[model samples]
Target: MMAPFSHTATGKKAAMALRSQLAQGAKFLLGLWMAGVIVAMFVIIPQYEGLGDAGRIIIMHVPTAWVTSLAFVVSGVFSALYLFRRRVSDDASAVAAAEVGFLFCILATATGAIFAQIVWGVFWNWDPRETSILVLLLIYAAYFALRSAIDDDNRKRRLGAVYNLFAAVTMPFLLFVAPRLADSSLHPNCAFIQGSQCDGITLELSGARIGLLGDSKLELKSLERQGDLVVADVNVTRPGYQVENHRPSFDLASGKPADRPEFDGEQFMLAVEQVDLATGTARLNIEAPGSGLLGNSRTLLTFFASMIGFTALFVWLYRLRAQLLMGEEWLAQRERTYGFPS
Candidate 1:
């Protein structure tokens, strides 16, 4: 026979006290970390002059991506634990992580689109990286929808674990390996987007080049025969444009040399070499892009701190769940052995 709610006051109080302790511990740490994030936003970031407008997006985008990745990983682990221990809390944690992962993934995709607009000139470029991430979002959405469709707890946990494991395996392949198979329309083929290559010079754009200053001169052959340095003569059919090899060329509008007003290493300067946009041909150069506050060290530290704090909170919750399960099992055994009133 089921007892009245009032009959369980003692048990209820103990549960409430345990919950209060967990909540207090989590809330205090979470509140402190959130305060840090706010301070980083208003105080720390604005102090950097170079970040300007794009700096704000980093506060949003990077954390979201990190959390999204972390959440999915945690969900997969919890899903596997559910299959082993048959614990209800493990299933709950899996569900909670999945939900949070979905939310963070949404933020990641949206903020990434915003960043791409500012950096790459287009909001949605259908780049391979972007496409892979979108597919991951859809795949998790389907995972959640499947969970909702099931009513039985055991069956739900089993099926969800299977899917989560499959996703965990496939995600690495999609995010890490799949993008390398083809030429990227967006950012240059770097190590993160492309597979590793040997030490021999790896030029990304074979037919396209960009110079910091001056008009790009187009294709020509090397005049020097088998030597350390080769001189390539570029003919300028276009009027009013000067074409000189190795030496700095002048711009008609501005009297200053057309090359960058900074340091001139052979490799660095060579990257921004002769291009003929008219003929749609040129060679590639490997040079670092301009710097901004978004890439600063201090900003990255604060971002990482917030993410670590968030992960710690989840870790604490996981521990709390284990304690609660132990308490529940102990109480069940006591009731059975003592023949306590049900």
Candidate 2:
């Protein structure tokens, strides 16, 4: 009987050791994969059409934003499980995921600020997207603060889970719906997708076709060919401001917007999409800085790779943190029950 028990114990130890080794090996591979992603972001990806080298940061920024959302979703799910099952492990997982989400949210904000400074000439404009992300950060910050303030473990977990669920409910609205609903947003969505907020308007040189681009009004005055470029004279008018004629040109050779003029009193520029010199007609659109990013295949692929790497990193971090929290909880419970050091 003693010999059989010894053999069983040895088998259990071997299995645990193998699992530990496999986890370490996976972590090592993840590190290498992320390193390759970083290299590809700079070396393999081409410069974006409007954003240039600065656009490479999207590989980091967008992925972090995605991971932030994903982490929050995981936290919400675990929180719900904890509520239903009343399990300490579920509570630990929820808290771990929320902490990870908060960290990634900060990363997203930092990367976004860097991109904004290069493209929009300001690091901290109160754009809709920026404001929404700020609100999200604050919401999660409050969740952690709530956890720290509570004295009892059971009450803390219960209240924290409830608060986390509410916070998760706000995430989608803050991240996606709100920004798109704001007309004054400088985010560029029309470049890649049709029927977005800033879709270009067609105008004939008759000056009769006036359209709104954000808060500014635009009308085409003239269309003419200048060498290899098709130039359009557009009248831009903002509320409480006089009309101004701005010449936005498109390069016929490259089939791209060339001389884009900034909208009156706004950072967004006017881009000429199409021009018909004979009919004196043109398509004019408002373009925020860094528009048409990810149009390149290499850049798009690298961005996706970065997203996958960040997601895997999040999973690893979440599991490690959850285990640590579980151990801490176990020790605390032991001390409480025994009235002595765990």
Q: What is the alpha-carbon lDDT of model 2 when measured against the actual structure?
A: 0.86
Residue-level lDDT for 214 in candidate 2:
66
Flag regions of model 1 displaced more than 4 Å: 1-26, 46-51, 180-182, 185-295, 310-342
Off by over 4 Å in 2: 1-22, 49-52, 189-195, 204-208, 264-266, 275-281
Error of 2 at 128 (Å): 2.0
Q: Ten-residue segment with the worst summed lDDT in candidate 1?
A: 196-205
Query: Which tens-of-lDDT digit does each residue in 1-342 have in candidate 2?
Result: 699999999999999999999999999999999999999988999887667898888889888988999999999999999999999999999999999999999999999899888888899999999999999999999999999999998899999999999999999889778887877777665534342555578887666577876677887777778899988888888778898889999898988888988866667888898777777778888877767777778888887888889999999999999999989988888998999985
Q: Per-residue alpha-carbon lDDT of model 1 for 131-165, expressed as tens digits?
A: 88889988988888887799875687789888987
Which prediction has the highest lDDT against the true structure?
2
Clashes of each: 3, 0
Error of 2 at 17 (Å): 6.5
